[model samples]
Target: MESIKLHQFVPISGEQKPARVPRRKVNGPATAALLIKMATEILTASPTLRHQTNITLTDLAAAEKVRKALLKTPLQ
Candidate 1:
């Protein structure tokens, strides 16, 4: 009969917390698509929140720039 051996957790020396693994990078178009989907969900869930915030035109313009950049559109 073969016996199974379970691995035990070993804490790293001199470190109180474990190191964080780096996140995998998402490609450009996929990232933009995800952002658009998230925005749609948020807006649909809480339409009134948009009217209550202190988001200025400049902020909006900056966000538009980011959105355009994410969508790979040429800046005007």
Candidate 2:
């Protein structure tokens, strides 16, 4: 008679992977103010003058006006 051998497998435990950290939003008050200025310019511009790539003088002036106003006011 021949003897039989059985093999067993076991899982190895190791150090856990480094935890993932969430990234912080870099866009702050300055970006918000710019966005507000751009939105105001677009909203105030005439429909026919609204262009995707190019900004007309009127639109630029309007946006600049809003941006200046925003800068004059204190951020809350």
Candidate 3:
């Protein structure tokens, strides 16, 4: 079995605090399916996603492609 590594702690008072468990940067097969399934609900709850970008991902292959694209890009 494997565990996830954590980073990006926040400061509390004068000391740094542990950050919440972060989400997986890349969506796997199940994750992809779940995201697509929940996307309508998520969008209904928060329509801001419409302004960010419209993405349609129906499979794991598409999810992996998106993950790869996001992780490899650099910040401006």
Candidate 4:
């Protein structure tokens, strides 16, 4: 199985620490679809982050592409 490097920031006692978070390896089509779904949900739930950039429409369109691609893939 392959792995991706995903860093998460953790705050402890007023200090911000960058930690290397372990993410499940997307070894197959099913895992890819799952990752896409999770990413889309995170983007949708964080409205403030989405609105931070002026190109919210573009961002949303990109996210939509992810969803579409996930739908097209046949999960096993």
The best candidate by TM-score is 4
How would you encode candidate 4's per-residue C-alpha lDDT over 9-65 as one tens digit per residue? 855775656687999655475566677667667767787766775436567678668
**Which residue pairs overlap in candidate 1's backbone?**
none
lDDT of 1: 0.63
Per-candidate Cα lDDT values, in order, are 0.63, 0.67, 0.56, 0.68
lDDT of 1 by residue, 1-76 (tens): 9999999998677858777999986576657756865665565456476567754445555665666666775323
- Write the number of the candidate with greater lDDT, choosing between 2 and 4: 4
Residue pairs clashing in model 4 are: none
lDDT tens digits by residue: candidate 3, 1-76? 9999999885568566668898767635445445554665465455466456664334434655665565555543
What is the per-residue lDDT of model 2 for residues 8-74, given as tens digits with 9 covering 90 to 100? Answer: 8766558666579999756455676789776766655655555654656676677777677766766
**Candidate 3 vs. true structure, TM-score:** 0.25
How close to the true structure is residue 29 of candidate 3, measured as C-alpha lDDT?
49
Q: What is the alpha-carbon lDDT for the whole of candidate 4?
A: 0.68
Ranking by lDDT: 4, 2, 1, 3
For all predicted structures, in order, the TM-scores are 0.35, 0.34, 0.25, 0.37
The deviation in Å at residue 41 for candidate 4 is 1.2
